[model samples]
Target: MAANWMRRTFVAAACASAALLTACGSSSVDSAISPDRFVVFGDGLADQGQLGTSFTVNDGSVNNWTSQLAARYDVKLTPASKGGWNYAYGNARISQSPDAAGNASTPTVVKQIDTFLAANKFADNDMVVISAGVSDVIANTMAFINGTITQDQLMANATQAGADLAAQVTRVINAGAKHVVVTGTFDLGRTPWAKQIDKEQLLTQVMLALNNRLKIDINPLGGKQVLYIDAAYQVNLFQGNPGAYGFQNSDTAICTSVDAGAGIGTGNNRVNSALCTPNTLLPNADPIRYVFSDNVYLTPEANRRLGEYARDIIVLQW
Candidate 1:
């Protein structure tokens, strides 16, 4: 079943790509309106179904915050995110390998930025939104906590991730983006997989440290053109207590079936076992599930808060 789903998803993406190529190949079209084009880059949390076939673990039909914000602000959204992607691939690593045919399935964020710049020149009013670095933390945390990776290595990777993200912001600025918003990492410790691994506290501390490093790095880059949006704070507030936030069944399993587990399991937990017995209990069964769908993705409430943060940053009214 999983293999079948993957094949179907790959076919759909290929067809979509072909259609886009066809559109681009046509004769001259209207380019006068010059709508504000928003270029988005990130991992699973920010990916709006852009991961190809091999990755069938994603929330179905849930539009990412980029699309939501685009609709609200009446701008054009171009999402170029891949699940399980790290900041290095999107920012620094892509320049070394620029061919689309070789890297389309997992094209880096830097490549997407290049494509956006090549296709459309950003005006002074255009904005660039970036959300990345969770994957780095997740990978490092697993290694360190398991005693296979060193603390120094983890910290170094995290610091490099922050630097890479900042570099992407700078590149977007250079590409004529007047407004650039870089989002902070979320509380992945609150996810079900973290609970299962019993590393929630450690991962949380690491995530906070990484976010602080990012804050310090981006704070210096702030001026009239660049801005940093702290999405971590908002998501933390939203997930503090699900009951208080109006979630009734927050304690139950986010996914009720086998396929659901497969989707949600892709985030951080690599456990493919226990497919029949669904793991539905939240952390200590506390009726406040931070992770939303079976794919272990953010819920609508979480994405809505993120959208609000983005809106606030773009409008400078928060």
Candidate 2:
């Protein structure tokens, strides 16, 4: 009942005042809620060098979305390994092991949350950000394509991962977090990895299933305290019309750096944006204009866009 009331109030108040859905949703506006610290938990997309470097091109820019979001709050985010708030790492799943990069030592999102909760308590001014599920989709889809898991099993795992993520969000909220921002998997079908594996349609279907489950499960938990951002919808808008988003190349990566090992868990000898720098960029390709840094990750500019989008939504709505 409280959640319903909050939802109705938000729609009525925001819609009546803003006069634009984007303003009520994710328009760029000055935020009134000032946070003391940002506690982050997620995979490569939000990782701020937990694995020595971010999953995006390392050009001394605001590469990770988490960092970009923190900048909007006038706060800098560092990895927990570096004694800061961000606990995100590359290729992390919600609760599974052997991450998308096939690294068994990578801490899962469950473990990250456990570490955070054990060490400290949430403050009212703290903003907790949870962005994950892309790695889960990639890992499960790869297993399905390799004949290790059936299509049914793949879909089931995706749905279960989404539920697991929602459970984690509920856990955090119940554990004293006043503000929690959640984002699910993006559209994997549009990624360069999907094209390489020739599983674009299947990946798209699986991604939608996972996000649908997340939406259904997370929506009931929604209020002014919890907000769910549609990452797939944001990515679709970016890729569907790249020109509007200042993207010149939405299909290809700007970086040419390749990892010799099983990087990003697609296979061996694949581009890993963590190793990508200004030196590794392809000739004649503008780093800022490209959407992807590698097969599965966004470039710095794209990350900035998402970060701003997330920040705006939080500001306008919350």
Candidate 3:
């Protein structure tokens, strides 16, 4: 009887306030409130200068695919805003904190989420875009390949990344977000730095394995509200045929400043996207036509293309 009263009260209040019909005839439905905002999270690939200067800025990422995606929903990404009610940051990882040894002061993906929710809540209409876990995969795989860590240890790290993703999703749901789209990292082993080593194929397998584990953990939680984009598939499509995307090289660094040591022999070189200004390399270098601006990060055009793919993914989910 008390449940019925609460339902009636909710109905009356909703109708009286010009709210959309939200009650679904059961208490199990937490919130039917849709949001008008686009909340984003994750690493440099999806970042828009929230952590500092961004990788894609030189190629005009501010006006690129990210803006186009938001335009679909009639909202543009705004970083450094409270509630992440917009784009978040660069260098975000699932298993590593922003303060970890080599992060350059960026926040962990989990902590970013926490910071956002500490000031706000979500609604059904709110769309969230997230792509992460590459850093974790890189860290784990490098350790194993270098014989500093075992394959078993790498596997454990992969599992932890999946768990962290699950936790992130749960937190979003609890915060009332309805449409949460999480993407896996692309095949990191195919990057310029990884391709130089004989272990590239093994690294690809490890990266894909981590993505598979993430897929396993997240797919069960899908509904009309949650989504996941197979990032490895998307990125491999580009690498498989660079000409299709107007790029001539996916295997060489476009920027002279690209650290040859990134995620490779030393594994201590952090990407300095800010150093990758347009035309900073050859006087005539076109940052827009390359796949990578640095060793492990995407060129602005690549990021733009990836954003376009992300938009398509979001459309299919709808």
Candidate 4:
């Protein structure tokens, strides 16, 4: 009877150990890997000062959409961006050279990717966001703006830009990122810079074409794994009615200098200083007008829109 009792006790202990191990295994399998790190690559819209200086004069604040997204999601961000970068620049960095200029003749997105990858290792749960192609449109359309480039070149460059963006997306996925979010281009024509070119419609078409190509590229990857965030739609929502989205007063045109009155707009108002002349009139000593800083960058409201879009893409529920 003593021997039988001892054997029964041992059997019970073994069963308990097996059950505990099984429980642990199940828990590990069920828990989703938390993404602690994020890598962002793009143009001035997504740039967090990668260019070392603001492309627009009088722009003092150096916050971009990616920075806001990082703050909202509580994730560490590695920003690799320059003003005026494009997709071809990103691909060139991945392939041969590490230097390529996009539409604005600035460093390409590829260089930023290379810089990020060289410095850090991407884990399975890591996320990478690619926001590019706008620079391509700007650069390709430069001739049109200056009366030196033809429409055909603009179309061809736009097509190339789409291909470049697609290639960059594929490269990011191939690098072992668990998830990659490809964002569509924003409406560039709405910006104050559009006034200089007078080709807002053409630029919009180029951006849309690039976005469609990106969709085609992403289709091969299973929907659950690779995701594409429709930033164009989200941004448009704000453009259609900035006041409805808490940006009605964030206009930057009213402020003449970098440190002028309360700053332009509230949060959703358009930063239109079209009537303001440069270097001639100022309520204050500063003569900057209509831009985040000077007369070319995005206003605080536009930055907020990008930030909101970033939040949607990075955060699971926000």
Q: Top lDDT: which candidate number?
A: 2
lDDT of 3 by residue, 45-102 (tens): 6666664456443545453345555655557666754333544455567747632225
Q: What is the lDDT of candidate 1?
A: 0.51
Q: What is the C-alpha lDDT of each candidate?
A: 0.51, 0.85, 0.62, 0.50
How would you order the candidates by TM-score, starting with the best?
2, 3, 1, 4
Candidate 3 global lDDT: 0.62
TM accuracy, model 2: 0.92
- Local accuracy of candidate 4 as per-residue lDDT tens digits, 1-318: 997699558545543443333223211121133556667776545554443432223244324555555555466454344322222222122222222232233456666677666766667766567777655555555546666678877676666667677787788777877777677566655554454446668877777777777777777885455666665655555445555454442223333434222111211132322222343233553321122333334544455445654443334311
Using TM-score, give the best candidate's number. Answer: 2
Give the Cα error of residue 146 in candidate 1, in Å: 4.7
Query: Cα RMSD for candidate 3?
Result: 11.0
C-alpha lDDT of residue 216 in model 2: 87
lDDT of 2 by residue, 1-318 (tens): 997799769755653343233323345577879898999999988898886888888988888888988888899889999999999888999999989978889899999999998879999999999999989998998898789999999999999998999999999999999999999889989888888878889989998888888878878775678887666766776677787677888888788989999887778899988899889999978887888999989998888878877776677677
On the 0 to 100 scale, the lDDT of residue 170 in model 1 is 77
Model 1 spans with C-alpha error above 4 angstroms: 1-35, 52-62, 76-105, 249-253, 256-291, 294-296
Evaluate model 4: give its lDDT: 0.50
The sequence of per-residue lDDT tens digits that candidate 1 reaches over residues 1-318 is: 997699558545543443333223221232222335666666555655553311112333223565555555666454344422122222112222322112334556566566666766667755566776655566567557667778887777666667776777778777777766677577766656566667777767777777777766676665466666666655554456554444544322443334422232233333221221224323343212333543234554456445654554444321
